[model samples]
Target: MSSNLLEQLRKMTVVVADTGDIQAIAQFKPQDATTNPSLITAAAQMPEYQEIVDQTLLKAKSDLGAGASQEDILTRAFDRLAVAFGLKILEIIPGRVSTEVDARLSYDTEGTIKKAHELIAQYEAAGIAKERILIKIASTWEGIRAAEVLEKEGIHCNLTLLFGIHQAIACAEAGITLISPFVGRILDWYKKDTGRDSYPAAEDPGVLSVTKIYNYYKKFGYKTEVMGASFRNIGEITELAGCDLLTISPQLLTELQGSTTELPRKLDPAKATAMTIEKIAVDKASYDKMHASDRMASEKLDEGIKGFTKALETLEQLLAERLKKLEEKAAVGV
Candidate 1:
């Protein structure tokens, strides 16, 4: 009998459940789970979580008073709901749960920090320790700066939407807890730009990008961990078997659990040390220039933030409708 690929991969990389589905997290038992506006929006529609949404809405209305505007009420409800989902996921997983700040706040350093504090406070109020929560921020310069401040307060952060080496270096310099370097999104940009149909796992651009970042991090002894995320296929996952971590969706997790393919350790600190890659320092000017020079990194980062922002808008709409129903019920004295 062959060992499950997921099991083998777990030996080298810490597998994080890249989802917001409570049932799915319970099934896979990943060490950690990440949630964004998109995942939260998708999970909010599930019948099982409807009560959570209702409860959050009711609490927001009760706390904010009846005079609060629908926008204010819905906004508070959405934040509570995000925390509610994270709270539930934390019950299933022993490790941390990453709750993202609003994507619209991606460029607002002060706003991001303020939201991070609020999110952490929510978790703390629910009796969840600060250590078990990661504030996920975009890799924008301002977002990274926000994380730097939050980290000083002992608030760990996961810098997301990262694509360029410049972003990784900056996050490390800021003392971020981790950086989720995307794999599939990078591949998508290259495929669209270069007109390449496919590339083998060994030569996959996404795979290589992550490998370089991992090598760079290890070579410099940066404390920030590299978690390969947004995978397109099992090949990308397998190629990064020795990554510090990998946040995988449930579908790929199932594929790995079912397959028995041998997984090789593709990255190592010793190997990275031997490589001749020069370390580059990144400041505001250099960071902007590097991101601009790399079309894929800049485009994808913008697209990712916009995508999350749209999803957040969708979630806000969902909460608004639910809030309306609640308001109607109260008006009718139900």
Candidate 2:
């Protein structure tokens, strides 16, 4: 066993890189990688990836041909831009890459499902398989329902922005492949709500929340996997050391690589199964009722969607500016 905490932790959990930066992914070599609109937009702006951004834009404009509205080009370009990044990520990681559907479709089940198919088709067109791509949808009841339909078609999904048990249980019951409970986001809510600076890693609201969800899934023998995501610090990551997976940012991954502390398993399936925990039957009615009472989940879910939507709007505007520059250069025969 390696003494490094990152290596030690990997013995029990699948480590995933959670950024859109290709250099970081190449450096850390995580098993899987995940990207959202915000990360993609940020990475697309980086000078190193300008070629990727330009190619996606050029292709989108060309495919639409003459008289295509700028809106149509922008929409198609965003979709292709996301997949272009996914393809680059997939080339580096042996596992899967999650490409999210538009956040605006978070509550639209039919639209989410349709978008997932479109993303998957783009990946397949590049000779990648559905198994190597995970469609990331928000954990709304509608999103979970959309995932249920995709899973049956052999397209796996990752239910993201999940904060409460209601959403987690609903995703599991829907037979979703994976659920990424936002550990740090949950903690952020509690700290702001309680007016505290910090909580001990053990008592952190996010850690406790994911621990509860992890055990519940294990105890019930649910096949759905729990991947702890959006961590704020090393404590939260180390606290959930034995989780099925942890999607971490590059900074934290570097810290773990530098630390030699021995990591211990905090979540065990056998222990969970032996504990006496009551089973709660979750459906739309119960999920709605429970979610309504869970302030952190509701608030965070709403805020998270709005945040991603704003990022996407920023990206569209940035792309428009970039497209104009490219067109001007081409017209000048430079």
Candidate 3:
């Protein structure tokens, strides 16, 4: 294991595990954990987790009638799955676990607020405190505003899928608990756009994006933590040595733990404060106009929302089928 690298990083950043696999999380021993609808949906379908799905359906049946609306059943399934994952993750990690709001509600302020509260309620019912859970929301201006309100009520938020400085500045002004600027996705966009080798780690666009956010946040004294996410490789990960947090996948975490290389310090608040940066603000209208103008941001935000929504829908369908089969078995006295 990269004990030296780990020591070097532990002095600067908090490492977080980005996965739905509890066992893998335990192996890496990240301080925090994160998961999205897609990861939860994938985990729910695994044979090892069939019992979780069956049990969720079984309980929903007892609380809901066969004719219960799919919306209610799906909500219940999502809550159960998220809480179950959080519960398992809590057993290993010492810090919070970020559970995302329904991606479909990314732009719906009220809906996003309601879902964040609902997820926190589920965790509370499971005996997990609000401090141990972070409701992850999209980095849209509306989402950031919703999270700002939620934070006032003592619910922490993790701004996810963030790609630009505008989103970061908005989240900072909004007083979010943390911001997870996507690292690899931005890299993907640049790679696809340039059709050439990406910039070296020192100049990689994705790494630079997070660095800019980190420096801005630190310089401005924004309490919102900066957590780098969606990394494509260890080079990107190691380059972001001193981010407030880095949510890495298990494979990459394993690689980081296995390597014995020197890890450099790429971010430091004292240094960041000395750099020149412009102060910006994005209100609802400005955010909308900016999002509309940037085809990449607009298209990617839309695509990511759809992808996550579809995964949630697939999980719900599977749960409904399971519920129907169980009901039929009980009715037939089989």
Clashes per prediction?
0, 0, 0
Error of 1 at 187 (Å): 0.8
On residues 174-262, what C-alpha lDDT tens digit does candidate 2 reach at each position? 99999999999999999999999999999999999999999999999999999999999999999998999999999999999999987
What is the lDDT, from 0 to 100, of the residue 291 in candidate 1? Answer: 92
Q: Tell me the deviation in Å of residue 249 in model 3.
A: 0.3
User: Model-by-model lDDT, in order?
Assistant: 0.93, 0.95, 0.85
Q: Model 1, range 1-334, lDDT digits (tens) per residue?
A: 8799999998889999999899999999999999989999999999998999999999998999969988888788889999999999999998999999999999999999899999999999999999999999999999999999999999999999999999999999999999999999999888888899988988888899999999999888898999999999999999999899999999999999999877788888889888888989999999999999998899999999999999989988998888788779989999
**Ranked by TM-score, top first:** 2, 1, 3
Question: What are the per-residue Cα lDDT tens digits for candidate 3 across 101-180?
Answer: 98889989999999888888888988899999999998877799899999999999999888887788888888899999
| TM-score pick, better of 1 and 3 | 1
Residue 80 lDDT in model 3? Answer: 77
TM-score of 2: 0.99
Scored against the true structure, residue 322 in model 1 reaches a CA lDDT of 84
TM-score, cand. 1: 0.98
Query: Every model's Cα RMSD, please?
Result: 1.0, 0.9, 1.8
